[model samples]
Target: MGNQTSVNRALTLINEGILSGVDSITLEQLAEKLGITSRYLRELFKTYVGASPKQYALYQQLMFAKQLLHQTTMPITEVAFAAGFNSVRRFNEAFAQELKLTPSAIRKQHAAGSMKVQANSINLKLSYRPPFNWAHMRAFYQLRAVDEMEWLGDNSYGRTITLGKVRGYFTAVHNSEQSCFDINIVFTDTDGLLQLKRIVSHIRRLLDLDADLIEVEARLSLLGNALPKINTGVRIPGVWSTFEAGCRAILGQQVSVEQAVKLLKLLTAHYGERVTVGGQEVLFFPSAEAISKAELTELKMPGLRKSALRALAVFVSECPDSDVEQWLKIKGIGPWTVNYVRLRGLSAPDCLLADDLVVKNQVLANISSDPQESELIDIIHAKDKAAIKSYYLEKSQLIGQAISPWGSYLTFQLWSQQ
Candidate 1:
């Protein structure tokens, strides 16, 4: 068998690149990022994705262009450039050659159909595999909604975003009946169309719209009584950026969720930018530069956590491309913090947060409550922090092997049980 692990990691990097607006990424660039030769990368793609890297990139661009044409009022020229084409002539040629239709023909067909166009906003449908428990997803965000920067309605969630010179807000309304989210995005910048692909990719990650629930559920089903009755559509609800997620994770240490959100609100109000879009006011999360320089006296958390926050901000500011593993060098940041960021911030599929308090409690409650395992519970709750952590780590790895690569989902499943 081929190296499934390498293929999975490579695919994740590609998706992350696209989500970060690297639409014109070349095979050599991807290979360099993967630390592999182009020949092997091409073979991996050909075997797994059924296409060469070039073909796959082209397909993504065309699919994005077609969605824009079918769903939004963007002009064909803007659509071409937005989808990473240098010129409309080339876009038209490629579209016709690959899809057997011209850009104008597609636009005409879209106009002929039932199209709903809203002024100053782009509306699109994001699909997901069925059995999506949107209520659980909505409740998760609703509980931790930050003021001004995020808002949650009964059936929808909206948040302000700052994406490299583009400031905007998007509202994703869950349509359970249709198995998708009807998202409406409004941007302050006129050049926002250029960032549409990245924006859509972020929304997909944020809502976890691309997960195959059937496969995930089936794999997670083997854990038996260890996990609560598997919630049908538990997904990793993501943050806007890794930096934002890191900040949230640092602030959340040794605190309740409500207290963590209060700290976030205070930090946002102190340093985050405020803007009005479509006559509605919202706040963007603070930038690394802003937090790196601040004294953080406004936050009432422990001084060590504040230091950790600034250290993270400085690390992100200096080495924007550093891996999450590098964050451990900072004092007060540990495995649980890094794993939390990986699970929710990057949506990594294999992270098992064994050190998490809720996870530990849930696992102990289920396993320790058994009369035969009572002595094991006493050993776990013993005074030695290091030993306790090691025990949980070992236990989580055992469970993680059972679920294999879906440990991130397992983490959420345990959290959802609380």
Candidate 2:
């Protein structure tokens, strides 16, 4: 088998390429991007992913094309290009060979007429497993949402988005009856059509629509009674990108969520791009270049934090593909900040934010009710940062092991208690 780290790194890059609508990426190009040989990548995929790199990419592209054919009224040629096929003939041949039916047959069976399409937008349904606590998810976004950048309605949530050079907005309405989100996407630029697959992938990550909560809750149940009954439908609500999540984490330090939201609003107002989509004015979260270049005097936070924010932006701006571990080298960024980025930014399944204050309090509350232990908690609270970090680290190791691979869910469950 290939080195585990290299194998994982390769897979992540491949998936990222697929999501970003780079349909034309050859296996050689993918290998070159990872600085590995194509033979090594093929071996890695065979051992871990059960297919060659080319086969996997083709499968994903075909699936995306199938979804578009079934869901949208776009012409077959458009669907072919949007899903990354070079020509309509190749798309049809692959569709026939893989599924034993043409795209037209699948579309006719599914019938796209059921979906509503607006003047400048396309509507698509994103599916997820049932027992989703959408109310909880909605409340989470509603609380931290920034004006102009995000909005929440009675049964829907909408936000502005920036994907590469394309800027637009989308609204995802909760369809509990259908166990899906009916999303309407409006792009200011026509490149949105070409980027349809990538946009859908981002929305899936942003809403966490593909998580298997049944298995997650089953494993988290191993934590026993330490947490309140595992909340059903609890999933890690993710941000649009890791850089955005890192910035939010840095700004959120030592402040309430409300205060953090205020800071985020100020940061957005100053650095984010402004665009009008479908007659609504929206702001795209500032890019790393924007944040790295500005002085950020508008933010009223401590000087160290503003410095940290700019440092992170500069790092991301320069090294867009670097690992999150590299962030620890920055001055103000720490374990909590990095893990927060992993949990919410990347939607990583195994991230345990043992260093978060709220997570620490919840864990402490669950493990003990004794007055002496409470006094110890008080003492730890009064002690230096090192002491507090040590205490939580030791305590978390006990439960953190039992909840392997689902620590992010456990973190959210603990947060839901407050």
Candidate 3:
């Protein structure tokens, strides 16, 4: 990598470290991890991200502390330590500086409107821009919901989650009245407040909490019948870990969604970590390192696909970014899987599955349709499948560029039509 690219990569890594609550790591240790001098790392962040890494880390921790105070009834001291503060005094000073309010007062203000909760559970709320299409989001996840670890029912989505070695489960129900999700979390311990922070962050991404729907709609609306109008909030559903999502994309290649989900379930059953809570069994998807070290011959998959899965796991173990060129180096991976992983896993806003079968079909139809649809079929049959896909991919690139950053949402809308 070029020096500037390396600096950008390090900055991205540092941002993730901060968000993941790496408050305990010393500056020297972090600099060593990034293979840069501490002084240079400080300069890069000051130039790009507008704050020192330490200041950013402190702000993230304090934000989590603020959320805990507003949502949970945990004691102030426990909240302090859980937010990575060494003492309640330090937490108080930081909290006062950031929000201009004491933790106790914040809790008191939230208590009046808080939901009734059991002793061991935490109740919180997740917000998104309005006009959300709950049905579309639920259907997308429900189609591939794993057997034991995840499920979508009625209007709510629930799943078992694992952070490091800590295991917990949470459910989110749409509260149309409040324009938010009423999230209920039941974990093994009340002291797992740090785990709660990680869980909340992942949940926000999973449901695309940070998306600006109004802006997306405005940009997309300019395309003018280029994409069907979605009256509600449509978002690209994200996974907790990019590794798992990449593996899924590999498994999904050239297979029906049902078949791919079936293989994933079997893979989980065979190699995933097993845990039980309240008589219900759940499995954490196997990690990249674990899969990279495992024997792939035991699985009933094609040899090329097995190789692809293992190669992907190994690549991810070494480098965590969603590098499509690196991914295409795998044996069975292609543009479709690479872009699918980018759109869903890394939360890349501009990605489009241009090579997707349904997307190609839709783009071809949009380009030319005839009376009785017979001419379209004849034209489709006249060309080789590769030629047709290449033709549409070129056209889709133009359409995708026109839409710019909301291409992922447009991709989802096209898929929903099928």
lDDT of all the models against the reference?
0.82, 0.82, 0.74
On residues 1-418, what C-alpha lDDT tens digit does candidate 1 reach at each position?
A: 2356556666655554342243456677667766688899889888888987777767778888898888766788878877777788889998988999998888888875534544456888888988888888889998888889999988899999777787899999988889889898989866676777777778898898888889999998888657747888889899988899999999999999999989999999999989899899889999999999999999998999999999999999999867788999999889888988888878877787877889888886777666666556678667666766677677777897898788888888889987
lDDT of 3: 0.74
Task: Estimate TM-scores for all models.
Answer: 0.91, 0.89, 0.82
Clashing pairs in 2: none
RMSD of 2: 3.4
User: In candidate 3, which residue pairs clash?
Assistant: 131-233
Query: Which model is ahead, 1 or 3, in terms of lDDT?
Result: 1
lDDT of 2 by residue, 61-134 (tens): 88888887778877788788878777788889988888798988888887746464454688888899987898
In angstroms, the error of model 3 at 178 is 0.9
- 335, model 3: CA deviation in Å? 3.7
Report the error of model 2 at residue 106, Å.
Answer: 1.9
Q: Which ten residues in a row have the lowest lDDT in candidate 2?
A: 15-24
Better of 1 and 3 by TM-score: 1
Model 2 lDDT on a 0 to 1 scale:
0.82
Ranking by TM-score: 1, 2, 3
